[model samples]
Target chain A: MKILIADDSRVMRQIVIRTLRQAGYDDHDIVEAEDGAEALAKVGSESPDLILSDWNMPNMTGIECLEALRAQGSSVPFGFVTSEGSAEMREKAANAGALFLIAKPFTEDTFKEHLDGVIA
Target chain B: MSTTDTGQRRRGSDSRPVITDLMDEDTILAVAGDAWISLVGEDEVLVPIPGEMPGDVLSSWVDVVGPWTGSVVLTTGRATAEALSRALLRESAPEVLDDEDVEDAFGEIANVVGGSIKAALPGPSGLSLPQVGHSPLVRNPADVCRVEVLWRGEPLTISVQGALPPLPVTH
Candidate 1:
């Protein structure tokens, strides 16, 4: 499976990738995008199976990317790994067609809980 | 006689609520403690006791703009910042870390902590990209919510301070 990870922080992107491995999802191919705009473009170029994105990013935000994808008629599975996980943001994400939101400072266990069926 | 047509007493433009009014020290501590455990390490604990920061301190922060407009500043010694960078990098940490690596890693911590704090406050707010350098100045003493804690026996302080200077006190 190809998974696209979008985040402005190089360190955070590393952490998310590491945690995915720790959650025992190491077999999937990983694609990296530094911002939502890149992630949006890569969604077409890379054709990733799933997208894990940060909510706050430069240029287009993760939500904006998702909205664009939906507008373009792409039905890609998407989730958020972001610092902001307020109820309002969560609702906004859900309304935007996001699968789930895993707030930052997450553990491998948190990843497992969320990614169980989604990854397989 | 100067009141607007609506007739309600016009609140001064400077009447914006401070950080303290939105959230207290205990709430900030809880948020920081959870962030430390999740980001720093599983067993890492943040002691609530206050510690004196070293003279050569570094700060990482993210700005929160909305109902409350300010920055969530995390301050600690340079050595501690490096240590934290190493910790975040873990096995991936290089033999020697440069300034950029520390800045990125340290700023991320503030981002996570600040994000959580932003959620706790009244929202529809926007969070800026994380920044690392000297901390932002405290615009209003009454608008600050600061907490000092010891992490691995190192001193660190988190300050949620407003960016705008205090409104002039009306006579």
Candidate 2:
């Protein structure tokens, strides 16, 4: 499976990729996008199996990209890996068709808990 | 209604809750502690004891905009910030660290801590991208909640300070 990780911070992108390996999901192909707009563009071009995106970004936000994807009649599985994880944000993500949200400062176990079923 | 009563209503309308009203030092410490364990290391713990900050310091922060507008800032000695960056990068750390590496890694720490802080506050708030440099000035003394802690024997401060000045008193 292919995974698209979208975040403006390159360090965070590296962390997410490293955490994926730590969680034992090292076999899949990984794609990178700097912001939500890039993620949106890559979604059309790369056709990733799943997307893990940061909520806030320059140019466009993850939520905006998700909304746009739904409006375009796309059903790609999407999730958020962000610093903001309030109940309201979680509900907003859910209502927008996100699979799940993994809050930042996450451990390998946290990644495994969320990705075990989704990865396969 | 009396004229004085009308003025009271206006003051009430302008009243905004400060950082202490929403969250306290303990909560900020807890948030920072959890972030440290996850990002720094499992065994790494932040001691709550305060220490004097060195003259040479670096700060990283993210602005939170909502009912409670402020920035979640982390300030520490430059060496400590570099140490933190190295710990975060682990094997990925270049033999010689660059300014960009420290800024990116340190900014991310603020991002995580600020994100967690935002969640604890009232809903629908926006989080800004993290920045690294001098700390932002505290707009209102009463609008701040700061916690000082020690990580690896180095002093670090986490300050949640308001972006706006205190509401004018309608006396």
Candidate 3:
């Protein structure tokens, strides 16, 4: 399966990629996008099995990107990885059709617990 | 030239009193653990330097205004900043980092750590966005409180001036 990871910080993107690889997803194709706009553009061209996105970005937010995709009738699995994981934010993401929300400062275990069922 | 101007100058000079009341090294270490564990990739151990300033590496300056009036500045050697970036990015240490990139990375680190600290403080206090300075020397007044701590043996200088509510007052 192919996975898309989107975040503004290159460091964070690297961390996510590393965590995903460590979680035994080494066989899947992994792609990256720097911001939400780029992510949406990529989605238009190269549809992936799932998307892991950061909430905060320059051009558009991850939530905004999700909404845009859903509005266009695309239903690929989606999730958020962000710094602030307030309850309200989770509800908003869920309402917007996001499958899960992962807070920052997370470890590989945390990622697996939240994402394993969804992806596997 | 005027009394008001002189008073302003004096206040500025006395803004951040040399922080003699040091933060408990253990407490700061715990906070670092909470904030940097994932980013750092392993358990962090603190190393103590008997007489070194924290800002000796990753040097940058930012003015903290509003409830507090003074600057929160961090200075470090160039090599140290690169090392930190590599650790955070989980990549091999780069040969060098541009001045602006170093400042941006350092500023973001300060913002994240400082914001966490402020949230844990007793009352409301606001943290402004961080500013960066490349100069090795920082011109903070003698009175400012400078807390020097080592993160995994890397010197991290945290200086603060003016006490405000631990949380921001929404008025």
Tell me, per candidate, how large a share of the native contacts it keeps: 0.84, 0.77, 0.23
Task: Encode model 3's per-residue lDDT on A3-46: one tens digit a residue.
Answer: 89998766677778888877777788888998999999999888
lDDT: worst 10-residue window of model 1 chain A: A8-17
TM-scores, one per candidate: 0.93, 0.93, 0.67
Best by DockQ: 1
Candidate DockQ scores, in order:
0.81, 0.76, 0.27
What tier of docking accuracy does candidate 1 attain? high
Best model number under lDDT: 2
Model 2 score (lDDT): 0.93
Ranking by DockQ: 1, 2, 3
State the RMSD for candidate 2: 2.1
- TM-score, structure 1 vs. true: 0.93
In angstroms, the error of model 1 at A62 is 0.9
Q: Judged by DockQ cut-offs, is candidate 2 incorrect, acceptable, medium or high? A: medium
Interface C-alpha root-mean-square deviation, candidates in order: 0.9, 1.1, 3.8
